[model samples]
Every structure is written in structure tokens, then in C-alpha cells.
Target: MPEPDEICGVNIAFAVVGSKWKPTILWVLAGRPHRFAELRRAVGGISEKVLAAQLRELERDGVVCREAGAGFPLNVRYSLTPAGVTLDRLLEPLAEWGHQLQRGR
Candidate 1:
């Protein structure tokens, strides 16, 4: 097992993804890159402003990429970066763990 640099990793993990809607955002975007509106739609219940801020934070943390898209509206899409890709891979099992805990309850 790898020893964590921080004594409390749960705190750190929460710091990264602890936002009300970030985990869902990451999960939805895991399938493919999404436009700003698309992410809001998929995430459900997040306000436009909050989603935009979270996306910016994700981009800053190297978790998401902001890219310009094609067409008339001049779309902007967000994709998981290499770091986010690795994080998504890690999150899958963590998701299962949460499900298992739900089952046990």
C-alpha cells in the first residue's frame, strides 16, 4: 500500500472533489467532453454560475480542459485532461465502494 503524504487523505480528496456538484460533473464528463450547458443539464440542479465556477476550478487543477467548438454558436466544450482521466479511473472503484456501503445499509 502506498503511504499518503498527508495523514488525512479523505480530507484532501474531499478538498479536490468536495463541492456539491463536482463528483457528478466528473462522472458525467467521464463518458466524453461536454459543453458548458451540457454539463449543467447532465449535472442537474446546479446553477449556471456555480457550474461555470466549478468548471474553471477543475480546469485550474488540471482536471478539465476548456476548448472551443465548431458551429454558429461557437461552442465551448470541456474534457477531462490526463490528470482527470486518471482520477476518473480511480473514482470508478470508489463509486462501487459507496454503492456497497449503501447495500450494507
Candidate 2:
């Protein structure tokens, strides 16, 4: 099997983080796990339809894990998985870079 460095440069990974609202969403979750509504609010400006779609996609991508609670009204919460935690660590520098860019302006 070829190593990642052989197959591609870091651009592929950036593409993952480059997604719209994903960076902001991840930042919010880094603070604390949030349910659907909470995530939507934190991500502010994302439409409901799009927010739901993004959450589903994030869960599928293993960035977020969904836990369903047993209850009359189904309760579901989303938290960063270990994989996501690692990604968050990687993103910290990106966040700093963004800060620098803003400051430079």
C-alpha cells in the first residue's frame, strides 16, 4: 500500500477542512458536544436544511458520532469522535493562521 505522502500532498487533507462551515462547526464542537439544534445555532447562518445535511455527512465521515438515547421523544446528541478530536488538533494551526490573516488586513 502506498503511503499518503506518496499518493498526495497535504492539499487533500485541506480539502476536507476546506468545506463550507465545517471549520466553524468543528470549532464549536471543540468546546463541547452539542445536539442538532445547538450545533445549528453555533454554526449560525447555515440553513436548517443544510445544517441537517452537513450533520449527516459529518457523522458518515466519522468526524462526529451520534448517540441516540432511549426516550419517548428520541434524544440524539453529537460529539466529536477520536478521529475528529485529532482533526481538531490539526485545525488549531489553521485557526491561528486565519487569525493572522485577519489581523494582517
Candidate 3:
């Protein structure tokens, strides 16, 4: 697989978080670890299949971590990894910029 660092930082960042639902996913998870259903609710319009696919992609990119518990009824939770935390920090300024742009518009 091609490594993200091999490319420009902006390209890699976009590759990881540029999808319609991904930045929202990262924003939600930045607050705290959440269960799948909770994330579904928090993210608003994303379907189960799409959410799962996005989460899988994020996990593959090492930006998100999934924890599974063993039992008759399994419990799973997702949280941001260190890299994800760094991305979240970066997103803060971008989000502010969006807000300022909207105000200007």
C-alpha cells in the first residue's frame, strides 16, 4: 500500500479525512469514545453501511481504533488514535476558518 507520508501532508490529510462523513466522524470521536449506534445517532444522516465503511477506512489509515469485548453480546467502541488526535487539533483552525468564511458570505 502507498504510505501517506510519501505524499504531501495536505494530500495525505485529505485522503484520510476528506470524505463527506469522515470529518464529522472525526469531530464526533474527538469528544469521547462512542459505540457504533451512538455514532450513527450523533452523525445524523449516515446510513449503517456507509458509517461502517467509513470507520473501516479510518481504522485502516491508523486514525481510529476499535475495541471489541467478548461475550454472547459483543460490545464495540471506537476512539481516536494519537494520529487522530493530532488531526482533530488541526481541524480546529479549519473549522474556525469555515465559520469565518460563512460569516463573510
Candidate 4:
């Protein structure tokens, strides 16, 4: 049901974070933890449904941590896990490369 190329390490990594929104979500989480609404605003242009879905997938992949505060309003915060921090570090060079390309360098 999957292509041979999809079984490799690189592909496996991509499978976890291959979506357009995942990287942006991770980028925001990399800074600090954010409540669900705060995260939605920070990630801008992504629908609530999509953000919810992405966060769920990231949580399932062990890249994001969702903690619910014990309060009446139900404050839910999202942050990156250790593995996510490492992944974010790896993405830094790639982001730099993207910037370079954008600047026509």
C-alpha cells in the first residue's frame, strides 16, 4: 500500500512532519508553550479544524506535548518534546537554506 521509497528513514521523518502546517506548528511551539487558541492565532490562516488535527497528529507522533491545566476554563497548552526539539534544530539549516533561496543567494 506504500511506495518503496516511503519506507526509508528520510521518508519516515517526512511522514511525521511532511504536511505544510506541521512545520509551522512546530516552529511556533519551538519558541514556547501555547494554549490552543493562542496557537491557532500564531499559526494564522490555518482553520481551527486543521490545527486541531495537526496538533493531534503531532501529539500522536510524540513530537508535541499537550498539557491541560486544572482550571475551570480548561487551559490546554502545547509544547515540543525533546525529540521535537532535536527535529526543530535539524530544520534550522533547512530554514536558513530557504531564506537564502528567497533572497536570491
Q: Highest lDDT: which candidate?
A: 3
TM-score of each: 0.85, 0.83, 0.90, 0.87
lDDT of 1: 0.85
Models ranked on TM-score: 3, 4, 1, 2
Model 4 regions more than 4 Å off: 1-7
Worst 10 residues of 4 by lDDT: 1-10
Candidate 4 structure quality by residue, lDDT tens digits, 1-105: 656775686786888899999999999999999999999999999999999999999999999999998988888899999999999898889889999999995
Worst 10 residues of 2 by lDDT: 6-15
Candidate 3 C-alpha lDDT tens digits along 1-105: 556665687887999999899999999999999999999999999999999999999999999999997875889999999999999899899989999999999
Q: Which 10 consecutive positions of candidate 3 have the poorest summed lDDT?
A: 1-10
Better of 2 and 3 by TM-score: 3
Q: Backbone clashes per model, in order?
A: 0, 0, 0, 0
RMSD of each: 2.1, 3.1, 4.1, 4.2
For 54-90, candidate 1 gives per-residue lDDT tens digits of 9988888888899996788788889998888888888
lDDT of candidate 3? 0.95
Query: What lDDT does the true structure give each of the candidates?
Result: 0.85, 0.81, 0.95, 0.92
